[model samples]
Target: MSLNANDRSIAAFTMAGHALVHWFETSIPIFLVVWLAEFDVGVALFGVVVALGYAPFGLGALPGGILADRYGTRPLVLACLGGMSLAFLVLAAASSIYAIAAGLILWGIAASVYHPAGLALISTGVEDRGTVFAWHGIAGNAGIALGPFVAATLLIFLEWSVVAAVLAVPGVLAVLYGLGAEFDPTAAVADDADAGPDEALSPAALFSDSRTLFASAFAVVFVLVTFEGLYYRGTLTYLPEILHGLPAIESLALPAGLEGIQPADYIYVGLLVVGMAGQYAGGKLTNRIAPARGLAAIFAVLAVLALAFVPVTASGVGLAPIVALCGLLGFFLFAIQPFYQNAVAVFTPPDARGLSYGYTYLAEFGFGSASIALGGFVLGEFSQTVFFAMIAAFAGIGGLFAGALLVGGDRFAGTAETLEANADD
Candidate 1:
């Protein structure tokens, strides 16, 4: 289908919004080491403080979805941008740990609104949703890649406070851009005329029939997302620190005034940069492949990669091999996003896309936040080997659920086709 100028504009704006949301959220990890040193807190305690931000980021999604449904997505998107910008400004001004926690809490609440509002806008507002979602995923991955690079680079020249304030600028600009943009909430549903009756129900009615939703394929998707979230939050929370300890990275030659920056920082950024391709590829696959099958394949690879990471790190392998491993790991880790996102759209009614995404993120991010502390505790008390093994297990479990989903989906499709055939008689 041909996209009009308005459609193109909305997609661009939405993608930009996606990038900013991720940039703000992921940048915090890059600062985690700094905070730990500055505050003299234990890793586990710091993890909890960070979770204060992330937990809200996930928990707030449901209400954010509900609000987006009641109010227009445009306003909620604007609020998210504006509020996040202000939250960073708060972070920049923070004088103590309490102030920092306060800033993170505000940031989390602000960030929470984005996924529900943004995904709902795309899933419901755009006609070329598969393509749009792909582009949106790319934008998010770009933010994930750049957040640390930008934050790390800025820290070289400025205080973390100034760096945070600088980061807030994009959100301010997005807020301004959104104010002038035009969008049609009904455009998304209109594009899919055959949407089921359940798709058209309000949130309350949808909840009333929650049993039907859970009984269907969506429940399996939910389980897969939860495990995926745990893996994501667990591994990524301390990746930079993990990389920092690698002896190979410490020996790399560096330029003057850049000596303080670890090689792992550069590698971390590069790995995420590679994830953009994975996001694009995954998006394209969603158009051709069944979501559950795609998820199972990707998660299986992720499971293997997660298990291999510790071995590669401990092998005394050169920097190149480790970097290559990280690159592959990054690709599979992010590639799963678009597939599962598409899965949610496939399994749920179009009208409830917001709610579906809301719950999806709640599983991915809200419950996912627990891993931050868990990882910290694991690392502090045990070892990296155990941590990697745990992450591998999470991915493996997710893959199993995805496989089950594939089987269940096939059975359901067969049953539906048979019922339709009988009705025609």
Candidate 2:
């Protein structure tokens, strides 16, 4: 079915907002190392800064979701963009490590506000939530995947402050475009939502009760996503810092301070690019393999890739080819995101979609923050090999959690079916 111009515009608007959020958010890890180096701090403190920037997604998820349900998703999303733009401004002006950490915390809190509201809005805004989410996943992941390059490139030329200032452009534009327009979000929820169909419970009410099949489904996915979140955080958050001390990399005869440019970044980006490609392909398969199996497989691949990272970090092979292999690993790791997103959408409802997604993201970031903090501390205390090995172990643990979802996913599916039947009754 062809979407009318308005829905198309709305979808575009949502994507723009999502992209802007990702643009700034992706820079957090890279900035952690760059700023740390510039500030003359121990690399172990990478956790303190990164967590300050990332942990609030957990803290704000529920409230953000509730705001979307009670008020409206549109205004909330625009507000988030405005907040994000303002955050970049603060980050640009920050001086001391304390100041930057504060800025990151504020930015994290504000950015966290977007996911529940924005994701809920997207679930309603577009016609096919699965495809819409796949695109959303691609857009966000691609930004994350590409952000390091952006940071690295900027680091090569401009000051870090200027780099942040430059990245602020998209967020400001998103807010402006959103403010200039208006639409019936209720209409977007479902074609028949305006007719007072099945969507009775408010986002808050649904959140308060939390018994829907969708909510239960979210619980199972929540555990797995948490595992993925930890693994996710360990993967890129520690990348540049992890590679900082490798003996082989030191021998590359590269100039001082630019040694973080391992073949790994290319591999990581390649993996993400592949994953983005996978999201596109996986969306097509959501009806066949199921989001459960797809997510499980995705987690398994990420675990393997984590192990692969150990060697890539340790082995001092020539830069180009090893990096290419790294990218291939990333491709497989990233491919499963669409399935995870679709699973969230299918299991959720129009009203509380915000809360479902909000909580899911919260699970991801909260654990991710803690994991990075602990991982950073571990790196400070032990060998880089041990550090990478621990992250790999966590990946294995996360995979086990994700795999259990494969075992239990059907139960939630059955429960959701029963709830729908009861809701119908």
Task: Specify the highest-lDDT model's number.
Answer: 1
lDDT of 2 by residue, 107-173 (tens): 8778877877767776666665565665676777767766667877888899899988887877887
- Cα displacement (Å) at residue 347, model 1: 0.3
Worst 10 residues of 2 by lDDT: 190-199
How far is each candidate from the true structure, as Cα RMSD in Å?
4.6, 4.6
Name the candidate that leads on TM-score: 1
Please give, for residues 276-378, the per-residue lDDT of candidate 1 as tens digits. Answer: 8888888878888999999999988998898787877676778887898899988888888988888887776654556677788888998886788889899
Local distance difference test, each candidate: 0.80, 0.68
| Residue pairs clashing, model 1 | 124-188
In angstroms, the error of model 1 at 178 is 0.9
Q: How many pairs of residues in model 1 come into backbone collision?
A: 1
What's the CA error at residue 142 for candidate 1, in Å? Answer: 2.1
The runs of at least 3 residues in candidate 1 whose Cα sits more than 4 Å from the true structure, single-residue gaps closed, are 1-6, 29-49, 93-98, 155-162, 191-206, 253-258, 410-425
Reference-based lDDT, residue 290, model 1: 91
Tell me the TM-score of each prediction against the true structure: 0.86, 0.78
